[model samples]
Target: MFAKTQAAAPVEAPKATGPAIVPGVIDFNVPGCKPEYPRASLRNEETGTVVLSVLIGADGSVADVKIDKSSGFRGLDNAVRTQLMSGACKNKPGTVDGKPQQTWTKVQYVWKLD
Candidate 1:
């Protein structure tokens, strides 16, 4: 006699209970500022995207910037940092449970040749 096999149940994704904004993605109500990229090196002619991790302070300013993912170019990374430090990008402070709190954000910088 052959035994019947039972099907396994599908697992559901965990629901988010926090703010409506997606974690890591920039959602601090910040104004978009145009970023300038440095001239690309001759060796690497291909354009790439740089992912950055930014810490937003309670004062609605960028507290810190960390390069989570590099674009394989130092110049490009520096350019991104400079723009953030210059206060070019404006963002409202993040709130958690009705109180202002620091938040981490991931921003992408795309470098391409004209």
Candidate 2:
């Protein structure tokens, strides 16, 4: 008597999570996220990095923003926050397992004089 052989099942490929939008990606060219330098800060020559915890909606809109770390200057911090919350920044939503999801991500904005 001969034994029968079974066929192997097909395996599916892992899904791609696409491009990540980490803190390093947050910059002046982030679509509508270009924050104008505060006039007071500009005149005072204040420069620092403002760290923020931003909640992005699945529809690619900034839902909320909280300052994780201030830039030492209230004007700079407020400027960055205002820009994000003003519905002007159209961010690409963060993805999980290749699917768009509402997520909170850290964003850093650096204030520097040219």
TM-score list, all predictions: 0.63, 0.74
Candidate lDDT (C-alpha), each? 0.70, 0.82
Model 1, 35-91: lDDT tens per residue? 665555534675777888888776767788999999888877778777777776766
- Considering only N, C-alpha and C atoms within 3 Å, which residue pairs clash in candidate 2? none
Q: RMSD in angstroms, all models?
A: 6.1, 7.8
Model 2 stretches astray by more than 4 angstroms: 1-27
Off by over 4 Å in 1: 1-32, 40-46
